[model samples]
Target: MSEIVAVDAEPLDLPLSEPFEIALGTRREASNVLVTVETADGTRGHGEGSPLPPVTGETRTAALETVRAATELLEGEPVEEYRRLTALVRDAFPGMVSATFALETAVLDTYCREREIPLSALFGGPPTTVETDLTVPILPPAEAGERAATAVERGYNRLKLKLGTDVSTDVERVAAVLDAVPNVGLKIDANQGWTPKETVRFADRLADENVRLELIEQPVPASDVTGLADVTRRVDVPIAADEAVFAPQDAVRIVHENAADIINVKPSKSGLLGAADIVSIARGADLELMIGCMLESAVGIHASAHLVAGSGAFRYVDLDGNRLLASDVVPTDDGPGHEIGGPGHGVTPDR
Candidate 1:
């Protein structure tokens, strides 16, 4: 029956090369969890989940516990029923979106290995390459500028800087980055750290100062759809919804409210199927899409990258998960973008 014979999970602390700061909190390391699944015939696979307590409100401990419980529900299940099995894990733990994605990724990896197919084919499209924007966390203008310029030197044309602490300093941060690299593509994510008025003022000030942004993301708190819409209507740049969309219904609600022009889709926000639903909803609503990632490792980043590569539905890609990690196994830097080859998520840590 191609049944699962073993399921296990563990916690890991991925140390960051530098400190990460945002509107919500600061972290020196990413707290993550890993899940491993084995089939009756010795086929095995692994998945990783990264939880940002400040963003998703999911701590690593909680994610680890959820994954442990999910493994109980997954053992003895058929690998061929991967979709159904993932759905069961997702339904059994409604709030554990990141955890369920880990389970789904692990299950799908195992299934693909068993069938000798590519997990990159999960979204029904051929594999593709994506250029990602490395993120500079909220820091002093000079530090932010240095990081942005460094990313540019490493062949990244686009850079995303975290703002929303103070509008004045935030503008200075942008200016510093521009000073470092005049023509680099820039995007800002406030992480729901400001009000609607503050958002409008910030965007207008940037426009007045000749600084251009590709998009302004989630300036207000997640649930404030009215405020989000107000900012979107007021700002010259495109407004993107990030934390505001945690599920398919959340995306539909934001669409109905006209809250955002672009919707940021993260696999950690929903299970794989749910994220796909949101992507379809965005397409149906004529909203632009940006595929995002949490502070994930290669295990999780590779899985999400496969989805992004296979879907090819995004206008923007921010898949640099916790970039300054002490050990990022994938060879993402020193290149314009990342590519996946071979089968079953195609993640090799040769770098």
Candidate 2:
């Protein structure tokens, strides 16, 4: 008989020092869902998903509802069948992709555990570790530079600088960071702050500085495909689609329209299956892919890390959610998060 599985979700409030304000929305803290799935064989798997403001309008209450709905669906079905069910019901609830992803994660974890294999192994494991970049949120130029220096000191070789504040201040922040950490490769995330004209001007300045930025993410508004395409044509640096590319179709469309040179993939925004499809679409379009995450806990971060490790398409990755968290959910018996070696996501939160 097929194993019956159950799932659960809880709302978590982890605070950030300051509210992280972007063009999409403001986040005072990260509200996440902790998902667990179990089988009759007495095996259990776990996952977490951080509902981002851009995808869900920062609706924590709605996110909780979405997860609750997902739980009801998982109560009796075979754990592996979740992806199909999720797709069937997702269109009816357009704003709950993050929640859908949380549920999907639990099922994937259960499937991986049942097979006694790591998630990376299921996707073709990587021989080497996946390296990731550190992110610096928007702050005063001097403070931002210090943060960048700290990241460099911590052995990070790449940095993603959050922009979307004053363009002048943003420029100064970039310069300060580069000055402090000269060897760190830099990427700017405008978070849909600039208009097409402003994006062009900003890109020109970044180029003139000869910083040779890795890419510019979401320089224009999220909904303006034409504007994004226009900016892509004018910018010297590669353009990466973040907020603008949430779905596989979005990735395909952006690539087909030449709106971006790279696509940022986040597992929480796109369910595990959707994220895989997005990566495949990017490869088909010959666009580079980066795996990213919101401020999540070890469970979500580890799951994303395992996915990136298995997918060679990820040229840039951001899996630092564990570091951002004030507390960890990984069991005391689990040792360091990196050591959770098993099938599924290897994520069983202590909670």
Candidate 3:
């Protein structure tokens, strides 16, 4: 309701509790940019961007620079001109998705907070609590199994195992984890590490071993839509497209090719508005939806959780990015494993 006063962007190197390993590589910390928007009325909103080089092809330096540029575009504008500001940022940095997400989130958060409404309400859905799956990063089979068991003990029923090495080793990893927790729901993410042949072989072997899987995510590279479709047809388990679908067009293409049974929506990949478009496309195509997070702090995770809780469209949530952090920017109860409290995303940042 007031004029925008100032915008600030800063880079953060949030340490991870453990090294996060996937098919692409390992990360010991998250490289994120935190953005804050302040209005003339003294109301402020917070946002965060965690750039995954393998996914968004953005480095920390790029995210910081993009946010700085966005700040310049947004300052001196009316607080209500959020759409215009975000559009300008997107146009200026076409591929800087994470930076755009940070700017959009900060502006929207400020608007919602000033209005005393939850962010979910803006999305036209009542806020609802959702459960999240804990990820078991790639490690030795035995070590991976131990981590899975520990997570199950900590009240998590769903476990997402990182795979995509070779077929035999991947099978061993899955088998070991199953041995550790036989009844836990299993979701495997290959992170575009496997080929069509390897995906099929892995699926067939899992069936032979009587390993029931909840889903398999991104078995093939993002560019290989037809190859993903081939794997989807060959496997009994549901296939979710993560890297394969970043925008509405990508979702449409995947649906047209029957490449995947589900689509993963990450706000950082497409910004909040773009994520909404992707969700619309997925719903129109009768595909299931998932809300995932890049390795972000509570600032970003809280924003994403609000979107997921409000839409009520997602069947799966992987918002444990905060759990992997050694410290959080906001006070939250056990990562996103439970509902956050307060207005907006129920978050109050310490700084």
lDDT of 1 by residue, 1-351 (tens): 499999888876789888889899888888887778899999887777888776677878888889887777888889989878977887788877778878888888888878877777878766667678899999999999998888888888998899998899999999999999889988999999999999999988988987789999899999789999999998989999999998999999999999999999988887677788998999999999998888887777777777787887888989888466888756555454667654677663332
lDDT of 3 by residue, 1-351 (tens): 887789888887889989999999999999888888899999898888888888999988998888887766788888777777777888899888888898899988888888778888877776667678999999999999999998988888998999999889999999999999999998999999999999999999989988899899999999999999999898999999999877778888998999999998889887887888898999899999988889988778878878887777888888888887788886666632657534666566786
Candidate 2 least-lDDT 10 residues: 331-340
Ranking by lDDT: 3, 1, 2
TM-score of 1: 0.96
Model 3 off-target regions past 4 Å? none
Who wins the TM-score comparison? Answer: 3
Clashes of each: 0, 1, 0
RMSD of each: 1.8, 2.7, 1.4
Residue 6 in model 2: shift from native, Å?
A: 1.9
- Cα displacement (angstroms), candidate 2, residue 175, comes to 0.7
The true-versus-predicted C-alpha distance at residue 134 of model 2, in Å, is 0.9
| Candidates arranged by TM-score, highest first | 3, 1, 2
Per-residue lDDT of 6 in model 3 = 90
**Candidate 2 residue lDDT tens string, 134-242:** 7788888898899889878777888888898678788898899988988889988888888988888887787788877998888887899889999889888888888
lDDT score for residue 236 of model 1: 88
